[model samples]
Target: MRVASEMGGVGGTTVMLAQETGLARLVEALEGTAREIDVTFARAGSQLGEGLGLFEGLKERLTTLSTDLSGPEIARAGTTLSGLAGELRAINDGLLQETGVLQQLAAHSKDASQVLERLLEHMRLITILARSARIEAVSVQAAGRDFGDFTSEIVALTTQAQRTIQNCARDHDHLSALLGSALEAQRDFEGRYGQALSALAAKLEQTLVEVTGRQQRSVALTSDAATHSGKIAMAAGGAIIALQSGDSIRQQLEHAIKALRLLAAVTAGTGEGAALDAEARTAAGIVLRRLEAAQLEESARSLAQDADSIEAALALLAGDTAGLLDLVRSLYQGDGGRSGSFLADLEADLAEASDLLAKCDRARAGVDRVTSAMSTVLDTCQQTVAALAGTVSSIVLIGMNAGLRAARIGTGGRSLVVIAQELKFAADQVAADAAQLTPTFAQMQETSVGLKSGGRLDAAHFAALDQAMSESLAALRQTGDRLAATLDQLTREGGGFASVVAQARLSFSNAGAMSDLIASGAAELERSVAEAAMPDDPAAAAAAAQLIERQVWPNYTMVGERTIHQAIVGALLPAQAGAAAPVVVAAPAQDEADDFLF
Candidate 1:
């Protein structure tokens, strides 16, 4: 038993190791694949960089070679030709001088002339020989240089040709070897192909058996699927009917609520419409009770639509608050108590409504917009299908007509058969498109009617808000104008008061300085007068001092002169009943006047 237990444990461990090994190998393979992908990308990047660098280098080398070899060679040859022409001209001049000397020697007859003639002939011959030798030497030198250049070029060409021949021979040998290898490979491949074909035939036989079995299974599956699909379609139809019914009920409830709310508002506005008001309230209560009952019993699907309607109504009511406030103000004639009471209650109610609407609005709008967009899209699809059908029908009719004419005309009737078949196919396609579009359009039309009705309700609600906003904007404009006028008046009055204060302060400061100057001058004059001797009798002196026919006043006046004159005028002037009193300044008393002397 112990041996068997150990064996079993070993077996279990071996199995676990095998499983772990398999998992490890799977992970390694995945890692290897990822590494290979990264390596491939890196290699591609390197190759692309290398290719670009090589292209740029090659371009630069080719441009340099073209300039250095072809263009410079032509320019050098032209310079060489110019030098050769100058040498030829010098040779021609030497020949012409030699010819003239030979003519002069031939014209003499004495022994000296005969000797001169022989000498001139020798000179002419020497000159001709020298010129010929010079020309021949230059030609030989040029030929040697040309031969050397040609030899160098020939050697270079020969070297290139040898390399090309070697390469061609190597390539030819390689091609022969490759051809032999290919023949051997082809023989091997033919043998493998026979084996492969035999295996493929066997696999085909097996596959056909499997396919036949699969087809049988598919047939059974298809039948079962058809049955299940029929059941599912029935369920879907029932669900759609239930959904639509729920939607209808929800719509009715929303309509009833809207009517009741409107009636409530109207009744509240009226002072005495008791019987009609009672009837309206009774009808509203009945409708409200029915709606509330329906809401409790209805499916969750209708709640979305109800939520949407509630939200829109709340938004409209909130937007109309400013209008309501204005109407209340008009009724109360700006009485704070009445306005405050009405506004507080109204705002509280509106706030509650707004909160409730916020809750339902998001859900409602989402569903409605989705439904609306779907209907719009479906309608557009129908239109597109109809247009496509029209085009296809026209094409089919034209093709059919053309085919029929070709069939009547002659030998091309065989080709026209294909055209006829295509035309028939096109007609079938158009008919199928129309069939599909008809039901889609009908459904879209029905959905569109629902959308239009809902849209009208939403528009009406928003229209009230639009009107209220317009009124608010107008009131704001008037308030802005009034505030602007008040600001302007305040600014102008502030400026004027500031100017008056500044002038008063300046005048007061000037007066203080003038008073100080005058007091000092008067004290000095008093000392000088007292120090002067009085002339004889007191009465005569006093009479002489007092009697003045004309007195010249200085440009500067005493500080108290204006003050004194103002005081005297104020005292003598009669007071007008409605006019304001004038200000007066009192003169300083005796002690106060004496104190200024210091």
Candidate 2:
């Protein structure tokens, strides 16, 4: 009662003016601060949502990229490389065989030519002996005129033999030179081209396997991506919970605004002999100011704590997201714009293999042509050797007949007999030479035949393989290119989460500052309260701090907010200060209750 009397009376008009200009404005300002906090938290939550959006479908894409890298498309390319290698190897071996046979045929040609030349010398000697016999028989004139025909026949035979042998030698020379050229080419092919073709074939296949194998390693990358995807998914879940803190803070701020507005109501008393005098009212105002200060402090702390959590979650999410991008990029192997995709590399290897294999094919085909030409020349040589043998036989017969005729002529025929004997010996020598040449010439013909008839090297799968492999590689290229594009898009769009997280963190950290504004406005209104009331007492200040006006209790839509206020705030309405139990609170509006969940 003494405190009430000390709480000097204030007129309603004066109270209204003070409340209108100061308390009312403070209430309006607190409402503004509360809205700002709502907006700020809303935006922060939205930003967190955006951060989570960057990794959607990322795991599936990574798995697809891994599968494409090791798919059957790539395997087909490898097979093509292997097939080309085999074809080139076969050509190398075939050419070697054909070349060796041709080389042998050339040697045989050289030997036959030598034999034919020796036979020519013998034929010349026989012609000399036959002519000598003819001249001696004519000098004796014992039917020597008849001997002229024999000499003529022998001369004709010698001439024919000389012509035939010379023709054979010429043909042999031509064939030998041709075979020599082929042999030289074969040497070059074996020494240089053979190893090169083999290497190209092997390297084409080996490099293809290696290249594809390297790409297949992307499957290993999926392991890391899968882990990162799990973390991102989990972190996103945590972030969802952290983001919901905004709604809770928004509700708290709304409650704080309602408290300030109710303080305005206390200043404008509802009718009557007066409930709270200026002292009581002034004390209550101070209590509200302090409570708002506590609320502001609490709101700031909540914001900072939630912000820290969200930012941490964002940190992990961003890192894992970036890691997934890295894994996807590895599938392309930095071959994005270099025109060096898996398909490109495979095609290049195939082209090189085709080129080298084609060269080997041409070389083998050339040997085939050389062997064919050698066969023709060898056939001619064999015929010439046979003709020469026949001519030598005829000359031997003519020489024997001359010898017999000379024996019948007695003394005059003795010189003719000696000539005939020498002629027969020379003819025999020619026959011997021709006989030796026949086997050599026949061997050459056989070699030429063998070379022409040998199996040819083949690469019949080139056309089919090229089409099949190219199709497979084309598919792989599309997948790889898509992955490269995804990685590039990620780099441009979501690559830097650090800055985004920082901005969000900074915004949320300013939540404490917004609360400070509300507390500052409250202090300004308290100055008005101090002016209207008597000097502040410590007891009144404690009572005011402990007051929880019933006006604001209805707005405690959240159960946690009400529970926390009753337990930790140690606050109660002035009317209920001496109650036995806690005051009963009204249930929130349906709309408010609908959104009461944090």
TM-score of each: 0.19, 0.73
Specify the highest-lDDT model's number. 2
Query: What is the lDDT, from 0 to 100, of the residue 409 in candidate 2?
Result: 73
Give me the displacement of residue 139 in model 1, in angstroms.
75
Encode model 1's per-residue lDDT on 16-65: one tens digit a residue.
Answer: 35533532343343233324323432343343333334323323332332
Error of 2 at 591 (Å): 13
Flag clash pairs in model 2.
none
Residue ranges of candidate 2 with Cα displaced over 4 Å: 1-73, 95-99, 129-134, 140-145, 189-192, 211-232, 260-290, 333-339, 408-411, 435-455, 458-547, 571-581, 586-597
Computed on alpha carbons, the lDDT of every model, listed in order, comes to: 0.33, 0.64
Residue pairs in collision within model 1: none
1-598 in candidate 2: lDDT tens per residue? 2232323456656646655567567657666766776677677667766655645544555666676676765666566567666766776676677777877877777777678778778867876776686688677675553567677788888889888888878877777777777687778768767777777777776776676666568667778777887887788788778878777777777777677665665555443213655655655654565555556556656766776787677678767676666555545653553534545666666667656655655555556566656767767877887887788788889878977877887787788788878877887887787788878877876766655453455334444545655575576566657755655555554454535555666766665566566556545644543434322554544344334535544566666565555543344233334341334323335525544557
Estimate the Cα RMSD of every predicted model relative to the unseen true structure.
Answer: 59.4, 6.3
